[model samples]
Target chain A: DVKVTQSSRYLVKRTGEKVFLECVQDMDHENMFWYRQDPGLGLRLIYFSYDVKMKEKGDIPEGYSVSREKKERFSLILESASTNQTSMYLCASSSSGAGWGEQYFGPGTRLTVT
Target chain B: ELKVEQNPLFLSMQEGKNYTIYCNYSTTSDRLYWYRQDPGKSLESLFVLLSNGAVKQEGRLMASLDTKARLSTLHITAAVHDLSATYFCAGLMEYGNKLVFGAGTILRVKS
Candidate 1:
């Protein structure tokens, strides 16, 4: 089974603070994604990395950024955390092989910005 | 812009009942995915529909796709309490570069 792990399951931060969420995947997938889930809005992609050191902005990438310095590790950074940025953050990884194989997700990190 | 929409944003069903959730998209896409998310948890992949008329089933859940109509359906048969979750269907746009997700259908199965 593919294993995706996050650094923290829950986190609380003050406004204007910097926050970092780390994700690591056991499988050598080529694609990694960061998403935030909110009630009713479903999951919206924030950033995605297709290769090491490469990144692309998704739909809601304004207040967020991402880093993929290593193949197995990806990190999401909040420049200035705010209450509105508090949401369940998810990390997913998938192989670039045939059929766009299923993206395995981590348990998610629930960040609460106060 | 690519848009994905799911109907009946909320569903309440009884055990031994059957229901279907609808997902519609506004662009040409060959890949569609079904995912289930429990409260306070990340998404779990349910099915991947890669082509028109493709269907997949697991346990009591079934998903099908129709590229021509830009639609997908997730059907639950003989629902159980454990089947309750928020179901979302996402369409791959930009040739699979990104996934556009629907608002999601929150299914609640009562005993």
Candidate 2:
């Protein structure tokens, strides 16, 4: 079975603090993504990595960065935490095959910034 | 830019009823996906529609795609309390592996 695990299920941080959220997958997928889920905005992509050390910015990449140094690990970094950045973070992994394969998601991390 | 839209952002229904969630995309895409998410939980893969007229069913949920219309529908038959969750539909762009997702429909089923 494929499993994606997040570093923390809930987090709290103060403003101006630097925060890091980690994600690990056991499926050995080539594509990994980070998304933030808000009430009305739905799931907005923050960043994605297709290969180790290769990252791409998504629609809502501002104030967020990602690192993929290993195949099974992807990390999201918040340079400066703010109240507006408090949202549920999700990590997903998918295969890099020809067709559109389903993405497996982690349990998500709920971050609160004060 | 490709945009995905879903109708009826919130749905409330009683058990044993039937409902359909609609998802439309702004651009042409051959691959579509459906996902279900519980409150405070991550999303789970429900269906993947690859081509036009493609239909897949599992248990009480059925999903179909129409590439020409750029539309996909997730129809629920005999809904139950377990089916209460947020459903999202995403469109795979023609060029890249990025997926554009709709704003999800929140479903509530009452007994």
Candidate 3:
């Protein structure tokens, strides 16, 4: 079984503060993704890393960035937290092997930016 | 731009009832996935449909994909209260393996 772990399950930050959400996967998957889920909006990708030090912007990357210094860990950074940034964040990892490669997700972190 | 759409955003069904949720994509995709998410929780992968006419079943839930039509369906048979959750269908775009997820269907099963 694959396991993805998030650094925090719940977090609260004041406006204008910086926040970090961490995700680590035991499967050593090559692809890691960060997504924010909102009601009626589904899961929108914020950033993704295909390899160490390589990152790509997804649909909703504004005000957010990502880091992939190692194969097993991916980090999401909120430059300046705001009330609107409060939401559930999810991290997923997938392999580069055969087929499209099913994604394994972490438990998720619900961030509250006040 | 690849787009995924799910029909009937909300559904309330009685226990032991059956229903189907539809997912449609705007373009070609390499694969499709069905995932279940509980409130304030992460996603649990339910099924992965890889080809046209592909079908996969687990428990009382079955997923089918029609690549030619860019459509997927998740059918629930004799659903139970414990099965209540938000179901999302995601399509892997051909180019970069980026997943595009539908808005999701919220299922409420009652006794």
Candidate 4:
């Protein structure tokens, strides 16, 4: 069974606070991505990591950053949380091999900024 | 940049009815994916179409891809209440391992 776990299912943060959302996968996947799901915009990629300590900015990475220190762990950081950043955060892991594989998503973290 | 769009963002139908959700992409895409997301839950991959004129079916849901048209369709047969959920279609980006997703279609199956 494929499993992707996140640190929190629901989180509340104050403005100007630094927030961290952690994700871990047991599938030995080489690619991990973070996406924010909004009502009308669908899921927008924030950041992704392909290898340890390697990161790339996605379509909407303005207020987000990510860290991949270990093979199975990926972390998303909000330098300063804002109300506009309130959205459902999802973590996904996939294989980067020859053929593209379907990404396995985590349960997601619903963050509310106040 | 690639863009994916879906139509009839909200659909309501009675049980046993049939419907289709369409996905169109702006640029060329070789791989397409369909996902189902229930309320307050994560996404579940339903189908992956990798080639032109490819068709795959699982239970009551069937998906097809047309590379020449840059389009994909998810057809639902005999809708059930348990099939009520949001469906999303995504196109694989040209250069990377990223996907451009459509805005999703919310289907409500009523008894």
DockQ values of all predictions? 0.66, 0.75, 0.79, 0.77
Winner of 1 and 4 under DockQ: 4
Q: Of the candidates shown, which would achieve the greatest DockQ relative to the real structure? A: 3
State each model's CA lDDT, in order. Answer: 0.91, 0.93, 0.93, 0.93
Residue ranges of candidate 1 with Cα displaced over 4 Å: none
User: Best-fitting candidate, measured by TM-score?
Assistant: 3
**TM-score, first chain, each model:** 0.97, 0.96, 0.97, 0.96
| DockQ of structure 4 | 0.77
Instruction: Write out the backbone clash pairs for model 3.
Output: none
For model 4, the stretches where C-alpha displacement exceeds 4 angstroms are A98-101
Worst 10 residues of 2 chain A by lDDT: A95-104
- Pairs that collide in candidate 1 are none
Alpha carbon deviation, residue B79, candidate 1 (Å): 1.3
In the range B1-111, model 3's lDDT, one tens digit per residue, is: 789999889999999999999999998888999999998789999999988999999999999999889999999999999999999999887887688899999999999
Residue lDDT tens for model 4, B27-86: 988799999999999999999899899999999999999989888999999999999999
Q: Mind giving the per-residue lDDT tens digits that candidate 1 earns over A1-114?
A: 889999999999999999999999998889999999887677889999999999999889999989999999999999999999989999999888865746889999999999
